[model samples]
Target chain A: MRSPGSRLRATITSYLLILPAGAFLSVVFLYSLARLGYISVHNGNTGLEGPAQIDAYRFIVDDPLFRQAVKHNLLLLLSVPVVTVLALTIAFVLHEGIRGWRLYRTIVFVPYMLAIPVLGTTFVYLLSLNGMLNSLLQTIGLGSLRQDWLGDPSYVLGSIATIIIYHELGFGVVLFLARLLSLPEEVDQAGRIDGCTWWQLRLRITLPQMRSVIMAFVTLELITMLSWVFAYVYSTTHGGPNFASSVLELYIFNDAFSFQAPSFAAAAAILLLAATTVLIAIQVKRTSVEVNPE
Target chain B: MHGVSKGARRGWLLALALLASAALAACGGSSDTPATSGGGTTSGGKVELTFWYWGEDDAPGANGWLASAVKAYETANPNVSITVVPQATDTFTATFATAAAAKSGPDIAAQWATGPVLTQVWNGAITAISDLVPADETKHWLNTSENTYNGKIWAMPEYLIGVPWVGNKTVLAQAGISTLPTTWPELIADCTALRAKGVTPFAFGNDTYWTTQLMLQSLSSVDDVVQASIGKKSYTAPEFADFEKGWAQMASAKCFNDDVSSVPMSKGTEQFAGGKAAMTIGTDGNVRAWAKTLGEANIMLGKWPTYGSGPLKDYYNATQSTSYFVTSWSKHQKESAAFLVFLHSAEQINAWYAATGTPPADDRFDTTKITGAIDKQLYSFNTTGPQVWLQNFFPPQVDGNGNAPAQQLVLGGQGDAAAAATTRETAAAQWRAQKPDEVKNWSNFHPGG
Candidate 1:
């Protein structure tokens, strides 16, 4: 309805308003991604004197450590379902106003508030051969089951995953609880009035409504399990007991910092990012298919 | 139209105010640098120097000594302001690397002797000390050859770090062994005697890879490995297999603590300190700490047991602990060099002894000044014995990532020594392939000087 001149002027003004945000994204996001890409192909050099060594990728592909790290990352993915189900169950119980729900919520959230490094360190001591856990196990006559918790390669990754789940459960519980509490009371009342059992109400009514939120959380859990487990691994296991519990991030750290081969580190990082993207895409596609049912 | 002109006048004044504010902020940021970098004004302008170091964990009183030294240096040279940054032991190298890669950091930085220092030098992060210190002065320092790269000294050597087997006389006597074993067969027999008395023979933790490194050093000579790394000798040769046999024997003999891989290096040392182990091998600083509990008279430092009666049995796996280097990016090189030289002065030398309870790297350091029973043994071992540390010869990738875990595998009974030796050779080959220049310029130190 406006004149052509005014419409053009308004469009220009709108672009101008967005210019600062666009410029910030370009520098912080796009620039960092471009730098990472360049370093992936270039040889590792602290100074700007080295030539491009595209074969850095080949070195990563041939590395046994890199392969082991990938395998560990995939193995850690198994913990995602365990964490989600535990979180959802607790969230549902709290939403139903179970006895001591407030105390339970507070207790569950306390771990998420604590720092990961400190928690991981405390757990490392607890899980050691002569630690409290083993001592208690011995006291309780379960000494036969006690093993080298952090040292044994068979149990190291699983130990780290358990620590991560303990730390992350609170965040998941609080998140799912917030969504469950926000559901309309009328819908719940209708389901109950229709003679649905508690489990049926949760399964047929409440769970169906939580599909999107659950999917979002599952996606988040997938991403975090894959990438954000470095601190726990570093502080506790150090990817040790003969690389039994090594992860992609630990490999990146060792290659980049300890080994001083940032080029190879960059290549591994890029490959991990690509793999993560593919996984996330597949998850999203599956979620979409479930939603549309086409 | 008059009202619009008045509003535009207000906008112009606001813009000018903001510009002035930003300029003032920029000036304020620049002024804060006097504390960290550029020296504050004194009689003439003072030249501020920043020195970074780490080792509070290994050497107990190092940080306190540094603080006192800085105060003394500042009082002596009023025109110089020195700030000492105490770094943590774990991430010091990585943090320094990040700063070096950015071409900016403290004027002085801490480094390990050869391997770590050479890596930084290759990256152009450090300036050669030869450019700063006089040749006459540098010639008096011990282990200068380790830091020599491309025909120049790249770092200033600090105190010696030696891993010698320290025997607990009380524990040994409990097992009916009065004499310390000097040969391989004798040591194994001693281990059997200790185990019969329900005492752990060699208390070790594989998490930090110290025990594994010691075993590796004992089994093979440094020069042989260096030659193998450079393609002059084959790592798959008979000598390399000695490592596998030695480690497999130790593991099978139950010579180590039951929780070897579970605990860290510190914990294993504690086992020896608690008198649960008859013998343990660790650095001199660690030996000193153990002496506090076990009594100086009760502990005796000796060479690692002879490995299959080789000439290298006389060689000691000793190397300098942490060294210091001036940054290539430092603007006050002359002042920094002066501070570094001042550290070697006789007054600072005494301070080093009083503070660290360890001998200084200065050759002029009088061995007679060391009077403690443990201190005397360490001094004798360092001064009289041959020097070679396996870690100093290999790159971090080969030593840390590859050899450390491979050794753990051998200790854990998952893999044999042959497999570990082969794995280590493969890692060294990768290093040689990737860093051909490093291999080409590698120095193979000899035994017995």
Candidate 2:
């Protein structure tokens, strides 16, 4: 056995080894977080002003738009988890000894490789009045079924969500597929010998194994979807046919860069960060519960 | 992992710490010197000045004229050397903000007129250019007043770009329209006739906001009420009924193609050039671009329709300067100002106009050097009754003078004319209320503000 002194020395050396990474993380991420907090609380003429302290939290909390953005974000958050689970299930099915599995995988993963701009442009084109989707509807003698996908306020969020789901599903599917493929064959064999149904095998064994990956994917998707709402809203509706699809990202951008109100934007950003943190915490709890069955 | 022994790891960590220390030292090094002088030395050696601008890949050719002018300037003043760097348009604002925060921005930078540039001025990021270009000299430039912030000129006029109604001459002739419409009703009639000929009436790319600005300008005819609201004059007026009617008509008429949301401004311009459509809203500069694409003979430039009974009978012109400002953080402000003065010289202005096929801001430049018909037409438009676009007079942040959320609303049909008018009014009120102390003459209202 290693001596206590040596063990303590090794522990100190390991921490010393990670010191650079820790410092880097502190400087880049922690420093930014601190700066964000500082800016969020202060409402001076510019962000750097010290004496003028405005309660940024109160400004955002009182606004109806902020509440709506939060609601939309929550809705988006709820949808992503469902979509990720669905993707995982589909990926599990595709990993089975099914015909044309490679083709199905390729079809699912192709959109993930495409740039956001290209996908956004293509989706906008496809949903347009004179686009292929409308043309197809007309050809099928169901012209009445076609509606203004982007123009109608009722359909805008749903259309944006659909695009987001389609865009993110590919990555989720590929990730789940990789995880599914990496499962030990003996686990499947053991489940088969026990006469467990396919669903049971997946629920009891496969999903448990994929928990960490899922947690990681969930975090990544949350961050990406949160940030990407602005680009989609900007590229398509520009936050509206009437602010219908305006989310926190776009609102913050408009407030900060467009309106020259960095303090307001900083407040919005702080809220966003808090929201994201809460979401990550929930995911972590879910992951921990999954890992520790008792 | 195999190669990294414990000693090696320790050594690596030490090296990294040293590098971090060095980086921190470097960052802290400049803080010692006072930021006012920007730590620049005027020794016997070359005095290099950095210039930043948000332009395209095509800018270098246009900037090449300016660069040659700078070289001549350098020859005259042997100690100075100027370097022009063009930044990506989308990233320029963010980059400038970051640079301003870091206090390491270029000596001189191009600023869009209106809200955005005004925001910089408000934040004390820009140096006043009153000393560089005297008020007497600036008065000669038609649009210089638009770039002035709080009675202090912040930037010198580089070029004045104005929105123009551009149409395909062949398409117009084919549609049997003898002359361009001067009023809204006539425009509708013309568009209907063009549609009857199986031609797309308006080649609007609603994917971008500027296209919407084109349509909105046509509706309101850019009167004083609109201008004042945009200029943060008054925010309570609600006299934009005509603007709403225009938007409603546009929506109902399907003036834009069904695939408009998919097409960008460049593609729309291409379609108009290729004879896929009869007319599209464009700027004088765009007319030049269209001419290059479709050959100068095919394109016709006209004014946006007049809808009001204002004294300004001329068509709506979005005349704002592509201005350059000396950064307060600039190390070589004197040298930079000298170069900008050289750029604004008559010979350089005429040369840039000749190369770009767009008229120079300088009145002294001979127009005979400009050969393109569109250029001639725009020059004539400038000479005639020119009402500067109202949005250009607003603080830069309000609309990027005409670039931001306003354009987006135009494309999306979010805010009708009344709503746009109200929004403009509200924005002005907000500005006034927010900065009552700063604004002395908030009551002095012009129609367009």
Candidate 3:
């Protein structure tokens, strides 16, 4: 049996090895978070010169813009399922070894490799009222399908979600495909030997095995829908056409930078961070919800 | 006089950098920065002053003029070195705010006049120009009253710009309209006349929201805007709310472009530049730009139609476009002040007008030196009377959240004037709820006093 002293020594060694990365994270992330928390309550001055209160929180609660932003974030959550299904279908098809599977894989992952700003700027022009998207629709005799893709309030958020899905699809596909390729070939052979149809086999066996990977993807995407959509929205619409596409991050940005109201922005940011923590917590404990079809 | 040509180059990297910069607004960060106005120099006696400016988008040759001016100033004062950094419209306020929080930024920075400048001053970001520049010199500066707070001028005016209704005479004649609008009823009749000829009238972009300046014609003074923002008065009142009806009427009359909400302000002006539309409201610099594009003879400049019975209704919409100010933390405040004073000298004044074709904000500049008839008219518009840029009087929050969105509501065909008024009132209440100290500061603010 391992001695208690030896175990303690090993634990200390592990901690010592982790110290650099842990310290780095604490300085970069935790420090910023603490500073953000301070800015939230404290009024703008040389720090403690002014009274610190929850005035920022009160302001955000009553702000119709803030409410609209939160609503848009919730609406974007609907895109998570659509992204997962699309990624899974693409990954599944490529894993099946279609004739151009290698080439298709390369094409699928290319967008993920492109810088997000480049994609956003390109799509903004392509989606404008007189942009190439509408022109192409006209040429293809699909003129009726052309709407004000980035202009209309009713459609702007959906358009942003669509852009994000297009950009994010490649990352999800590559991750799922990597997992599928690592699985045992014997498992598929056994399914075929049992006279299982391709569809039935995927539904009964393949999907069940993918639960862990799927969980990881869904979690990342949930966090993404919550925190990482600022670039897409800012570059394209700047949370505009009357804050129709405003997200929590953009609201924080405007409150901080544009409106000269960083106190309010800091308040919104702390709320966002707390919500993100709850998301990570849910993902970590997801083992309890795991299902076994067998 | 805000000429912001905010381009679309932002992405994840940009936002991440901004967030990182924002974190520097921490209480801990300010103490370590150049918060104190220490000496500006290296080991030698030479002084380097950094000037952050924004103008090229509105005034085409401003960058070139600045480069020449910098070179000239350096040659004249051998011991002084100047570095000029241009600012973008979208990032201007945020960049300055980030610098302000750290208490370390430019020796000299340019700002949009009045509210944008005073907001920073209230943040303790600026050193009052009255303390830096001599009274005799500052007395000659036009529109100095706009930047004055508590009887001290916080910033120096550089150039004058006015919001003029720019019409393409060729396009107007094509629509069978020879005269431009001077009153609300006449403007509506003109919109109908242009629509009958299948010409789009009153082209506007609402995403950036400055076009709402037209609504300012309904109010008499900056105090009215201040009172509404602090909840002393309702935005739903007839004086503050009535102009929204004009926007609603314009929207219903199909006065704006079909995609007004989606496009940037640049795109909205592009339609006018391309002669695809009849008229747009633009700065004096924009008037010069349009004159170049559509030929000087094809351009007509006039006041925004009289929309309300307020005393300011007939006031010409012209004022200083941007202000030059020394940072409170600037080490070379004296040298910075010297450079600002040189900007108003007769040589620099003539050079400024020659290069940019926009009027320099100095009373000493001879009006006869202005060549173009349009230039002469724009200048006259600026000097005519007490023009109210109602947007400037609004807190940045109310301008962005209330006035901006309310205009977008009408342009998108989503709401009426009443709804726009309610939106403005809600934004004012939101501001008051968030910033008690600012509310107090605004209450102390008497524009006339």
Candidate 4:
């Protein structure tokens, strides 16, 4: 056995080894957070005038365009989580020795790998007035169901939401499939032997085991959906046939670069960051329910 | 328990060490420098200057013209080298902004004459070229005053841009329309005729901001108040009502494609080129692009329709300068300014006009060498009845926020000619409310003030 001094020395050496990484994390993550906070308060000014007196935050809060964007982003945020859960459930089913599952998974996930611009263009073609969707509907004797999916403000967000869900479902499936494969077969077998139904076995054993993975996937999907509003906007309607489909990310872009107000853009970005933080905090809280369990 | 704790500590240390190495690698890696040819001195020991610009992928011929011009300028000076960096149009703004932030921006950069230049000027990113450009020379160029921001000329005029009605003669003939539309009633008549022949009346791509700007300019009447607004003056007259009326007509008529928002400018141009649509409001560059796509003989250009007789009798064509500005961060300002002056000279202007098919703004440049029919129409538009667009004259944020959003209003069934007029009036009023002191003295805010 090592002497107490030698063991203490080893502990010191390990801490020393970790010091550089700790410093790096402080800079990359903590530094960015601090910088964004400073920018949010002081506005995006470079000169020695010591931050413009303008209430940049107030401008963002009051702007109609910004409010609409926030609302749209919230809708997307709400929709993605539900979609992820459904996708994971579907993925679990396919992974359960279902026939033709490989083909099914391939067809579902193929859209996820498509370039955003290409996907946008394809969707635009599909959703156009005389597009494939409309033609198909007409041929099926459902001509009354034909509507301008892209042009109508009422349907535009729904169409975009559908695209988002479809695009992200593949990654969720792949992740859930991997997690499902890693789950201990004995735990599932025990649940089965206890006379539990397939759903009960899944809920009581498999899902519980894959809890951490599901949490991770949920966080990743939420962040991605939050940030990728620009791709969807640029591809389909450019935030509109009107402001019908604007999201906070696109709103920030239009405000800063498009409108030439970096201060305003910075303000919008801060608000978006704040919103994202709140979401992440809520998610963490919900996931950590059993963290301190007795 | 002790062993588990110790093992966890060791694992944590190892993970931290790995992360630290990654962080170091990220920071230490040299950024890939965008291509720059004039970094070192040439054989003649001349000061090399870098010029950044946006151009088409197949524009080596234009770049060749630029190279020859640079060579000519070098021969005259014998102590200067001009390096040209041609960037794709989409990457231009972001690249320039990044370069500017890094303090390694081009000595001279091409500027879009409207809000982009004004926004940069407001931010103090650009240097005033008033000292570089001769006062006499500036006066001779139409709409040169528009480039002035807060009593300083920020950019030099290169070419005057105008919205020309580009049409395929064959398409029009097929639609049985003999004469081009010259008024609102005539446009409606033309649209009706074209619709009857199962052809779309207008080829518009609302995916880009420029398309919307062109449409708005076409709808508004060329009044003094409107001109004043374009010139960034404080005017009390309500002019946008007339514009809104025109907008309503267009929207109600379904003159453009339903999928306009999805169609980019290039796609719209292609559609027009392919004779799928009768006409599109485009600039000289668009005309050139169309001429290349369609045969030169098939494409024709005409002025946007006029409204009333007398001073406003002439149809208004939107004009702007595809200008160049020297950044304040430029280390070689003298050399950069000298190059800009050389570019303004008749020889270089003529060469650029010949190569790019862009009409030269300089008076000394000859237009006779431009053989294309579209070129002739552009020259005529420049010489005859042309007016600067309102977006070109206003501050960046106002135009992007106020005018750009108004495009959606028109396209999305919420606007008309009267509503467009109201929107502009309301926008002007909002501007006045926002900056009362500045609006109170429009002359003081004028670049030439």
What is chain B's TM-score across the candidates, in the order shown? Answer: 0.84, 0.76, 0.88, 0.73
Ranking by lDDT: 3, 1, 4, 2
Q: Provide the TM-score, chain A, model 1.
A: 0.93
lDDT of candidate model 1 versus the reference:
0.76
Which 10 successive residues of model 2 chain A have the least lDDT summed? Answer: A44-53
Ranking by DockQ: 3, 4, 1, 2
lDDT of 4 by residue, A1-294 (tens): 899999999999999999998898777655544444454455332212346455668856876677888888777877677777878788888988799998888887898899877888888878866578988999999999998787777888888887788788888898888778877788888888889998888777777777766776786666656655578776887787566788877776654444434455556666666565566656655555532222
Candidate closest to the true structure, highest lDDT: 3
Question: For candidate 1, lDDT tens digit of each residue in B135-223?
Answer: 99998788777788668888887677788888999999988988778876788888888898899988887766554444444444555
Backbone clashes, each candidate? 1, 15, 1, 13
lDDT of 4 at B156: 78
Which candidate leads the pack in TM-score? 3
- The better-scoring model by lDDT among 2 and 3 is 3
**Each candidate: what lDDT?**
0.76, 0.64, 0.80, 0.64
Candidate 1 wrong stretches, greater than 4 Å: A1-15, A44-47, A288-294, B1-46, B94-106, B123-127, B149-152, B212-221, B327-334, B443-449
Candidate 3 chain A weakest ten by summed lDDT: A285-294
Give lDDT tens digits, candidate 1, residues A137-166. Answer: 999999998988888888888999999999
| Model 3: CAPRI class | acceptable
Model 2 chain B is weakest, by summed lDDT over 10 consecutive residues, at B27-36
Candidate 3 positional error at B122, Å? 2.8
